[model samples]
Target: MSKFNRPDARAAVSSPVKTKSRASGRTYEGAPGHARDAKSELFLLAVANMVSEDTFYERAKDRDDRFTSLIHKLAVEDADWTARLLGWLRNGAHMRSASLVGAAEYVKARLNAAGTRERRTHEAGEGPGAAAFGGDSLAYRTTTNRRVIDSVLQRADEPGEMLAYWTSKYGRNIPKPVKRGVADAVGRLYTERNLLKYDTDSKGFRFGDVVDLVHPVAGSHSEAWREWQGELFRYALDRRHNRGTVPNPDLLPMLAYNLAFLESAGENPECLLDTDALKRAGLTWENALSLAGSKVDKKALWEAMIPSMGYMALLRNLRNFDQAGVSDEVAEQVAARLADPEQVEKSRQFPFRFLAAYNAAPSLRWSWALEKALNASLSNVPTLPGRTLILVDRSGSMFGAISQRSGLNRADSAAIFGTALAIRAASADLVEFGTSHRPVRFSAGSSVLSTLKEFTSMGGTNTAEAVRANYRRHDRVVIVTDEQAWSGYHGADPLGQVPANVPVYTWNLAGHQYGHGPSGESQRHTFGGLTDAAFRMIPLLEVGQNATWPF
Candidate 1:
């Protein structure tokens, strides 16, 4: 019934049918509808040229390190070298209809088969000899050992981690004494550099690798961030400083940390950051105190810095200081001192080390409390303003995974968040249509949060359903998709089903900007890089604020 057979793809166009239907001007079963949607097909053809995976990779390979990392992750997680190469070898091999999930599954099956074969070969003693090479037996194994070492070294960031990785990966290749000595040497080197604090003489450093999965996470920058935080905490509220009249100037870094986080969240507090503009604005503690008329002028800067009571209190807690231990009077004094905006430098909210601050701020954590608030306050999020329902792709591929910080989950989160915003923007009640047509499958209407967590990172993407769901309503339908449209051809969409007045905005979320303006005479905003799904939320936020629905 479709244009092509399974596992094969047609070039997405057809020669005009020779015959015409007597009942209609043209009909190849659905040719009349298909002819009507041909223009959309033609537009997509040009778009496919501009932003396909191949095009994106070619553009990003050398130019962006982030993309390189993404490719590297792809290589590691779901590689299918044999099948992909076979696809290339065969003329009509690849299909956009095939989900990457299938490819991943194919690769997994091949790996299992290969493992089984290798074991069988070992049992039969038929695949080469114990040594892979006949001429140089010992050298061949030694070369394999060296390659394993190289692989471990390249991935491990720390000497300890490097040593551990080596021991784990090549324990049998390396003699026990050699492994122990290597780990000890690595730890000693790290300690000398102040990168590590423990004594190397400590035992149990030689870890046997049974696939060190958690080690990578433990040894990454995330780990360093944790250790650095603990050290900095001690340095900040180190109570011994109370012995002197002067607070250690070293504490400035602590405030800087908090300020940096707030800034990253788009909350820029002007006080702490010492920008040239601030200096020119007469925002200095001296000038601010002059305005407030305070005797705390001599210690003006110190007094003002102390009043960020929330900031200071959090820091005190992080430093292991018990609130109950601090006398009520001293605590009250500190709180009162920082209470006055004049004393606290209302401008001091500047972000200095925002990432560290955000990481450390347990108050802003994603917990049950925050989730409840998110559900309540952000409920009634508007749709793309005109659609009865907006179906979002929650498949793992939908996530924009940049730095693991912009996990494609945001695409899901953005959809939910955007839904809430849409509800807020709309004056009418949101008549919910709870049905999600997964490519090749469909499901009932569900909560955005559930979709966020359970959506497969792999699946056929059903862009047609996503775009065409709201044809009957006056509501606008918007689809921000990578435009690759991985779901197999569903024929020309039923666009004619919708009222002509209904607006449909297909944001071909390729990794480049095609510019924005209404194409169907409705506003369209196309971006280049967001196809990765990292900043999907950003567009929703921007749109919500301006209601930049091109129509």
Candidate 2:
């Protein structure tokens, strides 16, 4: 009398048209266990649940509290079996939308049914670290249960394709929380589906706090703030110890904070100045900032203060350093100087080293260096096909570089070069595949300009598919996704499409778009509709011409 009623409308319609026979060698029951394929998966989950539950102690005499609690937690967190069961009931698995909400019901019911345990109360006579159980058989039971759970959680960190395959195969029906946890995963993926752009977004700005440096380092303090911050810290430390000497020309920002301070410190003796900074020492940003710590300089709250190393100096004690040699006396002197309301206001507010040093440094070399470093890194980033079917993630996260074309986002421009290298001189077959589909070939001497002619970048990420398609063609498989897959390339679910021993050369795609893919962690982010993989990283300017992370 259930929905399985025989004379249903669907059956009536199908009466005229005979359905395909569930065939000979491949029966519905013949599906492989653990495979993303549905029939097989449902059978497997049911069997597993039945077996695990049977093995678990449930007899009245064997009713162990610790074992019961552990089993309860497993029933709560182990939603995988439930998700797969529900998924098998609906989709056969491998359906694109299956990852979203397929396996929700059965898992929810089981979790709710899991019983609770009594809370423990520590005995007054017991020591701080004493066990709640009186060192009896209960103690071992509790300890073992905790240890087992820890081990399970730890191993889940790199769940990778298996979890995604299983979840994606049946994730949709799994309810919201499990759905999110499975999708979110414990990873750094660049898929940008979560980000919502604000209307007429404000130009890049600092975070709400001034000291947190959420904003871009620009303007007033832009030129020499970093140097000033350093000069200040060192000078303060030195002055407290009574050694107010500037060490090197590199550390010369201390002399540059003010023409007056420079003259007073005898920095460049030829220059004349009217200031008492020399005798008292031109306080470094290090000197002033160490006094106030991480707090904002209240008196000059309106102004943007730059520490000696720009903002780096102010972020002290945030990093661990061995400064045991320095005396408490130095800290006390800095505190006393910082106590004066006027000096506190002046020192923290208008620390001069940054602007002065920036003005003095060689023609925007720092800016130039950053740009060049990125450019230089990408310069030798070998072309995709030339290397192998390095499935580069061309998702939403890739949108920015394609649109903005700046910073480390120039990889967009490098795509053409990849084809050129592979098709032109490579000894192997140069096959090109994007997103989750097939490969488009470009023969050597073919048009590099339009190699991406048929490449319409869209759709969700499919790392597994790209790898499987080219599994046999080459020695290595280069994956270029942002690794933001809630679900991944469909093969047979847990099979994960990727061939073992075939090292996937993961090249993370980053861009201006925030969440289309793994945003920054290269090989871990992605972008675009997943179509037209929108962006790329290109640091046109950097000091080191030859450097890149190990693939």
Candidate 3:
């Protein structure tokens, strides 16, 4: 008989245990359909937010490729869906992992299995672009060029056509991250066996062809270089020499080989001395600042590189400019350069950095520098027209790290976002909720770090009671939570306990598979993501309008 029909030895030895029945009137029943639906919601969350390995997708059985299956159907059936999925890969570094690339491959395999006319082909160097359908079909501005290159490298069947796209279609002015990825791919040509296994050396030759087309030499060029490996460097050197500028600054290091070659051949070093390529080499922000003091103009170097640095880099090296012979006036100019409100909106880590700085260094000598940057970054927060109640969940589960490598926890991230919103809103009341509800006092113009110290993790989640304690004459309620509550607080659903007229909106900071969120499958009053984009939904949600796609 089958295992399901047989009585196992372990079953005979074990005592029977009773399981608690779920409360009545709830939609979730732990049924197959329920779990399937939950997985579907998780797949959407993974696409809209960042993908996590511990979530529903990882727990799925080996045969169940529901998520990948859906991704293929969406790619073939709708171009807009394809654009959104591709666009989302640009959300963060976590989104650009190998798992996402594997998903793209699965989509291609499914298309092939169906024997459809839209089969992916590498003919004439056009397999990956086929996946995108066409250049005009999607908006290039929505994503970073580096993400596009990473996606292309992951999906392309051949390197030659991919190289052609970079030269002919993608353009030479690529971003640093994208250039790093491409350079790594090119550098691995001799070492990586699978990169260039084709019969003809046409791809490398084509790349060299493009280089000569762009920057022709007077004398005959040597054919000493092999396929693809040295051609990219050659192209970069030629281009840098032709334009008197380094196209991609990160690729600037490859010019070292050219410098040696030119030196041995009795060429002048003045050609590269005029270019700013050396200043952009892979180096720490502090090291780069120090090096730029002698070789390049300090003001120009600071202006070009400071905006690209992450919040942590900017925070950690606040004193570097001063020590690097940069005048106080120039340092202030660099600080103001990064403090632009428009640029702050594009950064994902400003809130976290601002909070970390606020908490770790309340009396830091350069605290004012970070505060000015933080205020400028938060200048875009729309002022609410009425009283707003902001509830921050500080449960034990939230103390777990958001990423495996990150020291920051979800609670702190929530606090950063919460404190910013509370401080920015026109009229607001801020409270921390865990096992019990309590009001938090954050004085006007007070430091966010000091305010964060006032909040701590309680043992259990009492969301309903917490909401009731703080729901005093407020127009709308915004709860920042993981959405996993214990039993109902005082025997009532959190939403049901609230005043009927007051709409409850849950901002799901953690992308849980099955949320305790009231809206359930119909996301009429729910949103997800770890950024300020969620706040934009509030204005539209108040008028009974659907939330726009935040990413």
Ranking by TM-score: 3, 1, 2
Tens-digit per-residue lDDT, 148-223, candidate 2: 2122211112222223333454552333333333322221221111010110124121111111211112222444
lDDT of each: 0.31, 0.30, 0.49
User: Model 1 over residues 302-334: C-alpha lDDT tens digits?
Assistant: 333333334433333321222124344444454
Which candidate gets the maximum lDDT versus the true structure?
Answer: 3
Candidate 3 local lDDT, 253-353, one digit each (tens): 33443344334323432222322343333233443444444555654555455655554566555555444455566556555645655555555443556
Q: Give the better candidate number (1 or 3) by TM-score.
A: 3
TM-score of 2: 0.26
Return model 1's CA RMSD, one decimal.
Answer: 19.5
lDDT of 1 at 152: 22
TM-score of each candidate?
0.30, 0.26, 0.59
The candidates, ranked best first by lDDT, are 3, 1, 2
